[model samples]
Target: MISKRAQQLQPSATLKVTGRAKELKRQGKSIVSLSAGEPDFKTPQFICDAAIEAIQNGFHGYTMNTGTPELRAAIVEKLKRDNNLEFDAAQIVCSNGAKQSVGFSLLALIDKGDEVIIPAPYWVSYPEMVRLAEGESVIVRTSFENNFKLTPSQLEESITEKTKAIILCSPSNPTGSCYSKDELAALADVLRKHPNIYIISDEIYEYIVFEGDHVSILNAAPDLKDRVVLINGFSKGFAMTGWRLGYLAAHPDVVTAVSKIQSQETSAPSSISQKAAEAAYNGPLDEVLAMREEFKKRRDFMVASLNEIEGVSCFTPGGAFYVFPDISHYLGAKKPNGDTIQNSTELCLYLLDEFGLAVVPGDAFGEPDGLRMSYAAAMSDLEDAMNRFQEGLATLTVH
Candidate 1:
């Protein structure tokens, strides 16, 4: 029998949609996929060149379980230069990916029955990671009116004695909303009252901001630095998704705890990927900036196009690549085939099956009134996707 933990853990919802789209493509269907979470851009040539050099130099051997010294040093410099945060090498732990870094943080901090506050709509893996750590997830629903951001009042109300930590994702996935400095300050004020609670700040999408700058909770509350586990990687920003390299910066004790688990579980991250990421931190940002500009253009086009669809309202996100449009107006509508679209999941499936347009359901991210559409595709693909998406919705008959 499978372990109960294995049985209870759900497969990634985003990957499921992507998998379905790929399966249809294998059958020669013209599928336009808008469900992927990673950037569509190729990893910059400079970063790849560094990886090649590492291989040529025979840098295959593993270093410390924590991370290679060069990579850790690069991370330290990058954190201070980019985030206005300071961290020593001893306080950093590198892992397979930002995903694993988050899971490791949860494992290190959470004991049985401890609670982690998650604001919805969230990245799908968060609650599952908490569950894997034997921690209860306290999901607080945010409002579309506020751009899907958690208010300070909501943060305060959600906290309790059992609360172990709260996860904050700016330039958020699915919603693409970036928190402002003032907003982070407000959340920090609430967090200050509860010093016992840790903050897991995920800044994996830090370099993709379009409207404004990406700000971490630590920037607002520097006093809380000792308790904040700052998570980031080279995936989204550097288009190095396949590299599987990420790291965390926290107090030395937290780093030690995470390192202990990582040492036993996966050992260190790849030596070659670490070298590539080091070059990413030290190399020029021209490619990264260019990608951001392209994403901004795509974001503008997607939001405008989606809003023009009757009953669909998309909030203009400050950062990230996804747009979560409120599709609740189409709920309870009947398809031409006489089937009812009862929820976001069904609506997404209808778009995929009928229109060859693949998007993720908001229900998978703890919001059922909307769905997530990624604008990370090429402009031509996005245009075609928009047409299919609009046509799919126009055909539904609302009761």
Candidate 2:
């Protein structure tokens, strides 16, 4: 029998869709997947080279429970250079990935019955992470009119005595919406008044922005540095998803608490992976910039093509590789097989079954009127996937 905590947690929806797509492919079907959040590009050569060097040098052993000194130093320098925030290595805790970093923070901070405020259309793991920590997740839904961003008033209204922390992911997972500096300042004004509520700033998509510079919450409200836990990793920016290396920077006390949790769990990530991540942090930006440019091109093409579809509407996202489109117009329409299209999950299943195109439904991300598609695949695959999306939607009979 599973523990109650395990029973309450939902498996990641993105992974489920990705798995289904892979299964279809194995069954000899031609499936185009837009489901995974991973970068399509290969990990940079220099980073890989570091890993090989580590192997050759026999660096394959357990590292410090927190992290290798070199990796932590690189992380500290990176935060200063990129985020304009300062942190000592003592305040950094490396984990298996940003997912673990986030989980550790939640476990360290949340007492039973504490509430974590999460914006809808969030990454699928946020709410589940809260549940695993025995904390209640309070969902705050954002709208298309506001570019799917949480406004200051909306945030202010969500806070309460039970609210222990708020998770802020700019260049967000499903929506790809980045908060502007001014927007962050407005949110900061509300957060400053509620000092008891901690801030979990997920900056995993930091280097993937298209429009402007990535803005960290600490940069927007330097006064709250003591309470902000900044989470980042090498997975997205360096195309090192398999490396499983991420780190968190917070107050020394928070870092210590998380380090203790991590010690008994994963201990340290792969020794080779830590070396590769250190190289990533200290390496050139050429490959990362190239990947960003490719993603931007895909974003432009995908948004334009999706808008051209009859019943679907989409907003151009500022960063990340995903585009969340409003597909409510097609809901309740009749399928050719006489089934009725209802919510986003039904729409996604219909698309996959009839069109062999894979996408994650918005219902899994806490918004039922939309769907998320990742453009991290090749340009040719994206082009084909969009065409398949249009074709699939056109098959629905008008209600």
Candidate 3:
């Protein structure tokens, strides 16, 4: 029998689409998957080499529940260098990935019936993580016209006595929208007034920004540092998703709480992965920069192409590798077989079934009129996918 917690949980829609695409490919279908939020780039050679060195040096044993001292020190230095935030190594806890880091932070802070403010068009995992922690998700839906960013007023209005934490993702998944320094400051100003609410700033896509600097909320509101849990990882920026390394910088007590949970659960991430992540932090940034540039180009191409589709419209996202296109124009439209498409989910299914294109519907992210397509694939694959998307949409006739 499944527990209520497990029964109430919805599977990750992005991974579901990706897995289905894989299955279709295995069955000899030509599926163009824009579903996964992973960089197509290979992990840098230097990081891989560091893992090999660690293995050869007999670093296969279990590490400290928090992390290796060397890796934690490197992470502390990284925070100081990039985010302009100061943290002792004890304030950091390395986990399996940013996903786990987020979950741990939620579990550390949330209790049953506590509310976690999540902006809509959010990453699919945020609400699920809250559910796993027995917390309620308060969804604040943002608009396409405003670039899908949550405003300071919106944040202020969403806070209630039961609000325990608010999750903020820069260069966000599902929608590649990013908050500017000024925007973050405004939100921080409102946050400063709500000292009771904790901030979980997810900066996993930090280096993937196409415009301006990646400004952390800590940079904008250093006074709130004690209450902010900064979440980051090597997955996106370093093309090390498979290595499964992420970490959080928070108050020492929060770190200890998360470390306790992790000790009972995963008990420190992979020893080899931690070594590889350390190399990523200590190595050159040239490969990361190159990957960002390529993603920028893909973002541009994908946005422009999606806009050209007859009933589709997409804004140029400021960062990350996704294009959240407004596909409401096709909702209620008729298929060639006379079936009516009632929602974005139906549209996504139609696309997958008709054109073999895999994408995540916005319903999974709390927006029902849009769809998210990751541009992290090869440019040629993107080109082919876009062509198929165009061809597929042309078959729908507005009722």
TM-score of each: 0.99, 0.99, 0.99
Candidate 2 Cα RMSD after full superposition onto the native fold (Å): 0.7
Error of model 3, residue 203, in angstroms: 0.3
Task: Give the clash total for candidate 2.
Answer: 0
Question: What C-alpha lDDT values do all the predictions have?
Answer: 0.94, 0.94, 0.93
| Candidate 2 residue lDDT tens string, 1-399 | 988878888999999999998999999999999999999999999999999999999999999999999999999999889888889999999999999999999999999999999999889999999998999999999998888999999998999899999999998999999999999999999998998899999999999999879998898999999989999999999999999989999999899899899989889899999999999989899999999999999999999999999988999999999999999998899999898988999999988978999999999999999999999999999999998998898888977
Rate residue 289 of model 3 by lDDT.
98
Compared with the true structure, what per-residue lDDT tens digits does model 1 show for residues 1-399?
889999999999999999999999999999999999988999999999999999999998987898899999999999899888888989889999999999999999999999999999999999999999999999999989999999999999999999999999998987999999899999999998998999999999999998656788888889999989999999999999999999999999899899999999999999999999999999999999999999999999999999998999998999989999999999999999999999999999999999999999999999999899998899999999999998999999997
Lowest summed lDDT over 10 consecutive residues: which window, candidate 2? Answer: 1-10
> Which stretches in model 1 have alpha-carbon errors above 4 Å?
none
Q: Which tens-of-lDDT digit does each residue in 1-399 have in candidate 3?
A: 889999999999999988988998999999999999999999999999999999999999999999999999999998888878899999999999999999999999999999999999999999999999999999999999998999989988999999999999998888998888889999989988888899999999999999888989888888899999999999999999999999999998899899989999889899999999999999899999999999999988998899888878899898888999999999999999998999998999899978999999999999998999999999999999999998888898996
Error of 3 at 27 (Å): 1.2
Clashes, model 1:
0
Q: Which stretches of candidate 3 lie over 4 Å from their true place?
A: none
